[model samples]
Structures are given as C-alpha cells and as structure tokens.
Target: MMASNPAILPGDVAREIIAPESYAAWDPLLDTFDHLRDTMPVAKVVAEDDVFEPFWLITRYDDVMRISKDNKTFLNNPKPVVFATREATEFARAATGSNMLVDSLVVFDAPIHPKYRKLTQDWFMPRNLKLIEGEIRALADKLVQAMIDAGPDVDFVKHVAAPMPLHVIMQILGIPEEDEPRMLMLTQQMFGGQDADLSGSGMENMTPEQVLELVSGAVKNFEEYFAGIAAERRANPTDDVASVIANATVDGEPLPDRDMAGYYIIMAAAGHDTTSATMSGAMLALARDPEQFARVQADRSLLPGLVEEAIRWTTAVQHFMRTAAQDVEIGGQQIKKGDWLMLNYVAANHDPAQFEQARSFDASRSPNRHMAFGAGAHQCLGLHLARLQIRILFEALLDRIDSVELAGDPVRSSSTFVGGLKTLPLRFASQ
Candidate 1:
C-alpha cells in the first residue's frame, strides 16, 4: 500500500476513489482531498498491491492551474492523459501495439495538438454555434416536453439530462436517430463500465481482466460501426461532424485509421457522458437547494451562472495524467523525469484557495474561472457547444418546470475518470 500517512491513507480509499467499481462513494475522496490540500497538496498516491505507478496527485487549485497552463513544461504529448490501471494499460498496449490511451488529441503535445485542434476549431465557435441556437433551443424544448410527458416523477438523468446532449451531438454528426440508442449504449460501456447497469457486463463484480475484456468488445464494436460511417461520409459527404472528421487532414496527410477512430470515439462518448453528468450534477444541486433553483428560474439572466457553477461543481471529467518530459519542480515539490502526475481537476475545482466557499454550490459564484474544461491548448474543444447546450436546455426547463424534489435515490456513475450521477431520480411540478 502507498504511504499510510499524510494526504491519502492506505485502505480501500484508493480503490474507492480511483477504481471504477467504487465511483458511487464520492464524499470520502472529497473529504480526504480536503485534508490533502492543506497537509500535502502534492502527495504521492501509491496504489494497493503496487498494481499502478505512484503518481503525484496535485490537489491545490493554484498548482493544478499552473501545471495545466504550463504546457511547455508539463507536457500532454507522448503519453496518456488519464491514468489507466496497470492491467488495462498493459492489455491495451499489447492489443493495439501502442497505448490506446496515448492516441487522442488530449494526449498529444504542441505542434500536433494545435494542428489537429485547428481542423474543427471554427465549427465550435460561438458564431457557428449561434447558427444552430434555434435548432438547439427547439431540441431542448422537445426534450423538456418529453420529460414532462414522462409525468411529475421521473429519473431526470434518463428522461432529460442523458438524452438531450446525445440527440444534439448525433444530429450535428449526422448520425441516424435509430443509431442513437446504440451510440448511448456504447458510450456507457466505454465510460461508465464501472457501474453494473451502465457497463452491461456486470462490472460491479468483474475482475480487471474481465472489465478490460468488456471494454475491448465495446471498442471493437465502435470501430466497426464508425468505420462504416467514415466510408459512407467518404462516398457521400455532408456538412456534419462525421464528414468533417472523414475529410480532416494534418500536415497535408490523412489521420491514421486508429487515430481517426479515437477522435470519433472521444467525440461521441465523451461528448454525451460529460455533458450529461454536468447536467445531472447541476440538477442535483438545484434540487437540494430550492432557493437557488427559484432564483435561476425567476431570472433567466442567472442561467450562465447556473451553468458555470454546474461545471465547476460536478467536475465531471476528473483527473488528467501528464508524464514529465524532463525533471521539473511544481508546487515546491521535485518531480523526476518520466514520472506520472495526476492533475486532479475535481480536487482543484474545490480548492479553497482558488474558490471561496468551494465546498458549497454557489450559483452566483463570481469570477468563477474553474478548470472544469481544462486550460491552455488542450482545453475542451466542445466547451462552447457544451455551455450553449446547457444554457439552452436550462432555459427550456426553467420555462416549464416550476418546482422539483428528490423522487428516489440518486446514484453517481462508477467511473473514476468521468464521474457524475448515473441515476438522478426526481419529482418536479410543471409550470
């Protein structure tokens, strides 16, 4: 076990916090982090049984901010950004001949990341998104109506939050409506496999090897499906994201099939999972604090605050892993070259030094520059679209929903990397 003292104690804590099966047990890690922030902000996280490398877990807001912004020093290229279990890492590397986690845009450094990001940069800008604002608003309205039709008591996660972004992203990508269910299913298998219901493979009781087997099967299905889609886009192009991906080039050359597959997978899966989690987190916060909900409902102007607060509060996309290119010092701690460090975004988002009342969910949090979408070059490409989607969806909900209450038990996804509520049951009264 890692050090039994200081920041993180040796126990089931690492498993509970970083493992997929224990994602539902949230507050323990948060509480431990609250202590770590003060005691040892950048402490080594040794896993149980030495199954994973001991990573420097940076929890303080300032340190995380510094590391994320200093892309030149704390590079994202040449490695995976999200820490994988050693077993999964070995299996993926063996199967793919390269680390599967090391392929995506988020895992690349300058020159490459910049070039790849530029391909679809203009498409996500506010002006471009403005063109789709009406369409999005209409979709949001339709989604809210669907929720209302589901009756007063609905699992908001299923009825409202989960489906809205999936439909929107699939539309933008020009995927068929019939395929939406399949896409969502694959997304759950990819991101929420830690949970029993979401994984579809009963990950709640599976060994790490079994879990990877499930993930491998899902990845195979996604690759086959997207390959067919890419070919179609090639044969008959359209003004959609899939078409954009199919036609994109870097350095006057086409992206390799594997990289292209990773891009599509990230967009399709991360797009919905992260957004849905944030939406559920926001709704959960609002549900818990009716006064805040009433304030936002009464004043539409507060919608942005609500959205930002939700992003910060949820911190859906948790930690990003960075490997040291050379020896460096961060937060007054020495980091050796080739070392793995976890920029724990959730911990950073709630750092007391950066945010006042960081533990409390304040809808009116001013100067809220949380690193929920990350910082610098690798900042989330879909951030604008995410914000636009959330704001529009909330606008629709505020117009129709007058009040909400917890209908039943709410459950968080059992995913260490992308954590949020999987089942958010709620009862709301319509306006």
Candidate 2:
C-alpha cells in the first residue's frame, strides 16, 4: 500500500513474534519486544514461510494505546481480529463466509459493535457485578478450601485458578454444573490449541492444517452446545445473561443464528479463561515474591493493587489485530490504508517507557494504566468481573494459607493468543 517493498522485520525476530512457543518463554519474548521498542517500535512482520499475512507490529506503549483508543481509524472488520495464518484465514472465510471464524463483538466495528455491547454492558458493570459478589465469594471460598485441603503442595492452576471463575460464569449463564468441564475443554481447544498440553490434541505433532481443523472442530462443538441453550432461553426466559442475549434485538429484529452463536461462544469462553489466566499469574507472582505476598496478606487494601498489577503483569490476551481504515502516521511510521497492525498488549504493558521497573511485580504501582483490559469501545466487557474474581479468590486464599511458595517450575501454555500459567505447583501452609 505504501511502497512496492516495505521494511520487513528480521526473519528471526519475525518468527519469534508469530511463534506460539515464544509466548511460553516469557522473558525472551519480552527481551525481543524491548529491543524492538528501543529500535523499531513499528516494524512490519512478514513470515519467512509466508504462512501468515504481513502486519505492522506495534510494540511501544503510547502507539498501542493510541491505536486501541482510536478504533475509528483502526477498524476490526474485513480482517481477522486475532492473528491468523493465511491458511486459517481462508478456512474461516470458507466456513463462515466472514473474515473471522467467530463474528463476536471483538470482530465488529462502529454501528454494530455498540448495539451488541450495550445488551450486556450494564450486566457487567461494577454495580451489577456487586449483586453477584456474594455468589462469587462463596465459590472462591469453596475452591480455596479445596485447594487448602489438598495442599501443603498442589497445582494451584488445576485446583483453584481454572475452576473458580469458570463456575461463576457458568452460574451466571445458567449452565448446569455438569457441563462446565465440557465448556473448559472447548475453551482450551479454541484458545489453547497451539499448546499440546492444554489442548490435549497432540497439536505439537500436527500440521497447520490439522491444527486448524482441531480449532474449527472446537468452534463447531461450542456452537452446537450453545444452540440448545439459546433455544431453551428463548422458550423460557430467565434473568441470566444467556436469556438477555437470546431475546436481544438489533434494529427490532432477533440476532441471526451466526451472531447468536458467536455471542454465546465469546461470553462462555472469554468470561472465565482470561480471568483464570490472570488469577494463576497473580498467584505465580506472589509465590515467587514472599515479601510481596506477606505485605498483601497483612494489608487487605493492597489486594486491589495486587489484582491490577497482575492484570498488567499477565496481560492474558497477548495481542489483537486491527486494520487501518486510512493512511496515517503512528510512532513515526506511515501506515497505508487496509494495512494490518498488531496491538501487542504484552509488549506495551511491559514497556519500560510506560511502567517503571516494568519486569518487577510491584503491587503498589499507582496509576497502573496498563493495556490488559484494553481501552475504548472494544475494551473487554468482562473486565470488572475479572477484577472482582481475582480479588475475592485471593482474599479467600490469603485467609486460609499462612505461607505459599513454588513447589515446582510452573509451565505456561504455548499460545500466541489468550495464555498464562497452565500449571502452577505451589506449597502452602494452612492458617
């Protein structure tokens, strides 16, 4: 769009940016980002194999923030909202007849986005979330007790982090308790398919085509499951979020089948997975820093800071793609119309320019304006719920455990998209 040949990222760096394994090795990825932000903050990434389309990688904090807030200039549609290979993109288009595999709020822009978001926006706000506080706290306590009962040593991610938020969101959606495991499995396959351990699908040994097939299968499974829920809610409406979506209207007409399925899938999957990742991250950080954990345990007020810092520290949703609607200058680089850009949250959140001592897990960082929940109209709808879940879980955890330390080396999920600790082995002493 700009020139016949634009400056391309170095092969090694470009590979690292797109590689799923790179995200699991967190420090090195951050180091790569640090180097990029210092030298070429806005670099074009073109895969060596040409598996994926070229997109401008935005690593600097200010530039990412500007692009995120300026959704008007950077539209989410007509391109995959998340990074996808050319093959995967084609598969999605062929399957759904749309740019995305799922046409949810994350992939919409402008006139349609606001309408869909408003349907459940009030339900996710702080005041409304407060109505569910008791329920969430009770669930947190139950999970924390179970963790304590099994601990002295336990995998925190398995015992506590993963299930607590899942249960809460499921309850809110009016899903039966028996179906949560199915939901969790589908979510992992959808978002964690790159990681063999998480997906349980031997993805490491699979070809790209095989991996795409596995993910598409997961999406199909989700749609089929939600279809039943939507039908039931339509027939017998309830106060749950599912009923809200089932009966919602756009321009006085019911949501089309695809949109309805997309809505349910995003809510059911994203509602807990991101929160689970952040919770595990917070526990991992505190387990590593005994002093910080002790300080938060003593001062209940610091729990808020701990939660906020963990969201910034983990940045579960690693990156989201945006398409340029018009020619513009960003971070001293000219972006041409229709060009794709990656808003790398992990890079921006860890940028030393924005956060002093960026790598350190400091719970007391005032004005921790991190891009974890993103910004502007597309900001995560489940943010308030995420924060609340983390706070309550930690509150219950600290109340029951006198001390906590790593029992073994933690393992992170190898995913370029939503990812965090998949295994967090910890030893704790009961209070």
Candidate 3:
C-alpha cells in the first residue's frame, strides 16, 4: 500500500513551483523540477499560504504519460483544466457561475469534449491542411525575408517569430491582415494576464481580483469582436474555420453564445502563441548552438527534429491541472478521489530517463514523445499547423540565414502558465 500523500514539498519550494517570477528564469525552474523528480516524483503540493489549492504534483515522465492516457480516471472537468489560484477559481465561480473563466475545449470532459473538439478537428488535420501548403510556405518565406531585411542584427521575435503563425491562423480564421496586431494584443492579455511584459497592463502589485477583472475585460473584448463575425458568418457563411464554428451544431442546435465565443477565442487566441513560442524557442536553441544550426542547415532533412525538439525544449504550455475521479496509485504513491493533480509538461519533457541529455536542446533527438502539444484525447488540435508553420519558417530561414547568435540576454515571460520568450536579441548575418 502506498501513502495517501507521498511527501509534501517544503514551503519555499512549493511557493516557487507556482510563482510567476520563478518561471521567468529557466535555470532555477529546471532546477526545481529536477529536484522534484529526484525526491518526490509524485508529491503533494501543500501550500501553507493557500495561494492555490493543494494538488498532487506529477513530475515523472511515466506518471504524467499515464495520467494523460487514462483520461477517464484523470478528469479535466470538476476542476480548472489549467492551473488557477484559489482566489481565481472562487472569483470565476461568483462571476461566471462556473469553476473556470472560459468553458473552451481545454476545460471540457469527454462525451462533450469529444463532440466540441470534433467540430474543428478536421480543419487542423494534415490531409485538410495540405490544401493550404502553398499559403503556409509563402507566409513563411515572407517572414524569413522580413528577417533577412531586419538583419545583420535584429530581434527575431518581431521580425519572424511572432508574425508567421499569427498570419497563418488569422488567415484560416478569415481575419483581415491589418487586424492581426489587435488579435495578437488581445491574446497576449488573455494568456499573459499575470506577466506585465506580456499583458502590457503594468500589472505590478495587482491582487487576484484585479487580475480576474483585467482578464475578464479581455475576454469581453474578444467575445464582442467575434460576436459580429459570428453573426455575419451565419448570414453569409463562407469556407473558413470561423464559418464552420458559426454554423456548427451539436445535439441539433447551434452552439450557445458562450460556447461559440469559446470556440472563436481558442482559434483566434490560443492558436498562435504556442506556435510563436516554439518558433522563438527554435531560433533561440539554434542561435545558442552554431554546430547544431549548421548541421540542420546542411542536411535539411533534420528540420522535423528541429521543429519537435524546439517544442519539447520550450514546453511552452507549462502545466495543466487535472482532478482525480477515484483513488488511484501512481509512481509508488497514493492518491484519493477528488484530488487535484498538476501534470507538468516541462518536467516530463525534460526528464533525462525519457530524453538523452534532455536539457541540451538536441535538434536531432528521435522518438521525441514531448508533451508540449499535450497527449491522448485532449492533445492540441492545431499541432499539424504548428509543425507546418515551424518547418516552413525554418526552411525559409535555413535557405538564407548564414549565421545567428545571441546578441543580448533573452527574457522569458513572468507567468505561471502559457508563456515563452518575451524578447530574444540576436545578431545574424544573411548570405
């Protein structure tokens, strides 16, 4: 028999594990995850200050994979799918009458989750997305050309990383090119609410209520903006993702306004940031390792590994919280019914047992079972698009990018979840 709570993390370690600032520094965060994996791979995160509810923190590769595959036992519903502070959860309850702020695909359980996810699932598959290959390549080339123009020295994030996926996803959504910046800003505020750099809200010294208010306001804007699109699409339906969503039905009725809005927000907001993060991460990894960059540059076939390793290296989605439906055993530890669990992708992806020299950013790492795009039934729907976007972007880059290296310190976003590099300074020379 295993213990009910295997081991509780020390107060300082526990707080740092959830702290937004701690995530900003990559080394310390990795150190914390490493320590957890070594000591209590399946430990309880008991916070005395109660910043968030107590949950089981799953740090090992095997445990996270098992929980992800057994979705029936580990539920996304009845809990916040993504991590939420106790204050934020209570705030959401009072405001939206739900435990979550948005009931998107990320929050739903099976039966309902499958039905909603199936709506746009085909739109993201490789067979369907292949039709847009030319468009993706063109966009990728354009961004790379922009990068070339910005060099011999430039900020890759601005010149290339941010815009490629933004344009691609926006194109699929039928958003006009000019409004992409506005879309980017809203998405940043929504996901990066806690990070002052990402939110642009100067969120210094803000309380939980204030953060909720700010995020709520952003969601409102997204809803209002998409509401008009939803109405227009219903009136004049076209062959776009938004049109599919606008006219989509479940149980013989149109999706409710809130659900419909959630669909739009996921497509418009959640689509690009992760890809952008991976793109920046790819550049960062290559910029730091010239030999690896040269290898990929010369071979060209290693582009897939480059793309995948970047996703794994970045592990941009961070962690998603799950609620245990019944008492279960995992990693020589015990769990109980109704217990919350944090499935940390960062720790799982970087686990040395799963990946050789996991922290070294090996662009050639094969069989890379990274959970950056998640796994099982709830795996990221837009993964093909992400891969295509990254592959094409790097294809264009490798063609012209003679060299790239760090110019100044790269800064990561100060956020507990859904974040990556805020600014990456690079010095590059194009042939």
Model 2 alpha-carbon miss at residue 218, Å: 0.7
Q: What digit string (tens of lDDT, one per residue) describes model 2 on residues 345-401?
A: 999999999999999999999889999999999999999999999999999988988
- Tens digit per residue, CA lDDT, model 3, 131-231: 99999998888878887777777888888888888998999998889989889999888899989878888788787788889898888889999999999
Score each candidate by Cα lDDT: 0.84, 0.93, 0.89
The C-alpha RMSD in Å for every predicted model, in order, reads: 2.7, 1.6, 1.1
For model 1, residues 1-431, the per-residue Cα lDDT tens digits are: 22333344455545554776454767777787888788778777788688887788898988888888888878875455777777777888888876553267786788788887887889889999898899989989998999999888899888889999998888888889999999999888877766788888767688878888887888888888988999999899999989999888888898889888887888888888899989999999989899988998888888898899999999999989888878877666778788788998988998888889887888788989999999988899999999999999998888999998898889887777888998998899997
Ranked candidates, highest TM-score first: 2, 3, 1
Pairs that collide in candidate 3 are none
TM-scores of all predicted structures: 0.95, 0.98, 0.98
User: In candidate 3, which residue ranges exceed 4 Å CA deviation?
Assistant: none
After superposing candidate 2 on the true structure, give the runs of residues whose Cα lies further than 4 Å from its correct spot. 1-7
Position 317, candidate 2: lDDT: 98
Q: Best candidate, lDDT-wise?
A: 2
